[model samples]
Target: MSWELVSGLETHVELSTNTKIFCGCTTKFGGEPNTNCCPICIGLPGTLPKLNRQVVHYAIMAGLATHCTINNVSKMDRKNYVYPDLPKAYQISQYDKPLCEHGYIQLDNGRKIGITRIHIEEDAGKLVHEHGDTFVDYNRGGVPLIEIVSEPDIRSIAEAREYVEKLQMIMKHIGVSDCKMQEGSLRCDVNISVRPEGSNEFGTRTEIKNMNSFTNMEKAMAYEYDRQIDLLESGGKVTQETLRWNPDEGITTPMRGKEDAHDYRYFREPDLVTIYTTDEEIEAIRQELPELPDARIARYESDFGLPEADAQLLVKYRKIAEYFEAAGEGLANKKTVANFILGQIFRTLVTDEEKENGAVAIPPEYLHDLAKLLEDGKIKMNLAKTTLDKMLETGKPCTDFISEQDMGDIDEDTLRTICQSVVDNNPKAVADFKGGKDKAVKALIGQVMKQTRGKADGRKAEAMMVDMMNDME
Candidate 1:
């Protein structure tokens, strides 16, 4: 019998606060191990936790962005657990009284995936194991996190990946989180099961824990889906357990038995009282939110005349989208600006070194000017691309390089002279064009451009070359 996959995700997004959630320790990504920790974060004796107001504000912003209803009063609870990375044997998190609930994220196909809740919690420490020794770093221990739990509405691996990518884009656009998978800022736990097609009863589910990359998330889900289906088809029972995805081997290995909520022994924390928010405060935050990805995409398509695909690409990154809008403002042919950014500007950022450090060196104004030059036909596309490469390498304005190289449209007299030379030099090409081979003129125009160092206007030179070829005929 054929089976269908049912999946949901529990995403942990690290908030972009300067300090840890309940302590004054730094939340920076990389530092000397344990140096970013403090008494409260490290769970030292005699230390009390104080909540960060910014963390709450950010949580509310996240809730609002995802259409979640913000809770007026939420309380922190102690999630009792024992782990080497969790300095606090019992983690301070939200249990029954989470900050937000009942939200949804709409996929591009208009399918709405329901969100169960979004709760604020502190991150656990990092465990670095090398040569039979395990080292714990508390630098990330108290970093603020918002765990977004989705419903089991996801049906396929592609939907699972799209859901995560869309969430990453939204969070990044709103400046709530960087959502960098490499830095461990954004991570996911996938709960998936398989059931017979058209059956209401769900199969035994398995949890894939702490997948950091979206690609890995999809791969892991795909592997688990097959594993469950194959086991049931072979007359074996699917077990409920936690699994780890080995990307190197492309398989999911069983980690441990899955634990239910009651297993954690969750209870309300006594140290922190019930947190509260007012409608006025929520409204103020809602007003302060920037244009989200959806609105920006709509504006790009309707106002800027961009195709939906191009608009989606431009808005994929917040910084890139803002740069595109700033440079393309008041310019004719805004689509040209989009193309240059996605094509030439993106190509220049080749190496990771160039991408990390050299991207900001070349100003957006250079791109704007280059697009303008192309739009006005002052320089053809081939010359513009060469100048763009040099601009990226030297961080100089496009005009300065254009002037130094004397790059501009070749005069009509010079273009005609070059075309005549090309036609005379290739009698066979001239005869081909005259014999009704329309494409042969392109070769003659290419010769003119080569002679003029890409300074000749291609359309004008093509016309000139056709005229010169006809004269010989």
Candidate 2:
């Protein structure tokens, strides 16, 4: 019997607010344990928790970006729990009344994963286990976070990855959070269940706690799917439990029984007041939103005549998209700009972090200058591309490497004379071209470029060379 997978993700995104959600403590990462803490963060007696206004604004912006409806009135609730990391025995969060509700993030395949709610909350501290002792760091405690709950719309591992990646991109684009998983800024709680194929009813679900990276998400989901299928096949029912993914052993161990809403013993937070936002305020925030990734990708394809894949690659990273536009300014063929970014620039920025941060040595205007030279026929692609590499290395302009003679193309008559001389000099290649070897013409063009000291346009020369070969008897 074939088993199908149904999955939903509860993604916790740490907002980039300067202070803790309910206090004025700094929200900086990697501080000494308990050093960044204040009385409010450590839940000292007689301290009142005050809400951060910026947290509410950033949450609304996130809600708007993900196509969610912003609730006009919302209130925070206290979720009671006993853990050393949560200095406050009760964490302040939103339950029934969240800041944003009923949102959906659309994937490339036209599937909209429903988001249940995006609520403002405060994060617990880090529990580091070393040498059989658990040390608590209150630095992250009371840090602002917005939990995005998604409905069980994911069916496959690929869709799960896309959903998470889309969410990550959206959050980063809105400038809400860094979404750096390594730093615990963005983490996912994956809820997975497996049922018989073509069945409408969902099987018993098990929750996996806090998957940080995409590779781990994919591997963990795949393993959990197989594990559940095996259990069902053996006539054993799966348990409803919370589990942890062990990357080293490639298995999920039971953490504890799954907790429902009632498990938390929720109540209204007495310290914080109700949050009320008006429609005018929501619209003002919506206006602050820059062009999102999907719209930009569509525009790149329609306006620049770029391929869909090319557009997606450039638009995935915020900095790369901005750099592409700035570099493409006033250029007739924007696709040339895309090619350079997707080709040469991407070749250097190999890692996702480097690409996401736009860690290129040269400025966007430097790229614009290089693209202008190519469009104006001042230099061929071969020379422009090589010069781009040099620019990337030295943060210098193309003029530093391209001389005046190398700037302009050889004259038409001179180019043709050079082409004929090359054809005569390389009869074997000409014969190879006559015999239907299409790549042989490249050798002829290579000679033309070499003879002109990279001054000749490789593309134009290729076209002219191919034509001359076709006309040969």
- Model 1: lDDT to the true structure: 0.87
Candidate 2 lDDT score relative to the true structure = 0.91
The deviation in Å at residue 47 for candidate 1 is: 0.9
Model 1: worst 10 consecutive residues (lDDT sum):
352-361
Q: State in Å the error of residue 257, model 2.
A: 5.4
lDDT by residue (302-348, candidate 1, tens digit) is 99899999899778877778888877877888998888777877786
Model 1: runs farther than 4 Å from truth?
131-133, 257-262, 351-361, 377-379, 403-418, 431-440, 450-455
Best by TM-score: 2
- Residue-wise lDDT of candidate 2 within 108-146, one digit each (tens)? 889999999999999999999999999998899999999
Q: Please report the candidate that would top lDDT against the real structure.
A: 2
Which residue segments of model 2 deviate by more than 4 Å?
257-262, 420-441, 459-473
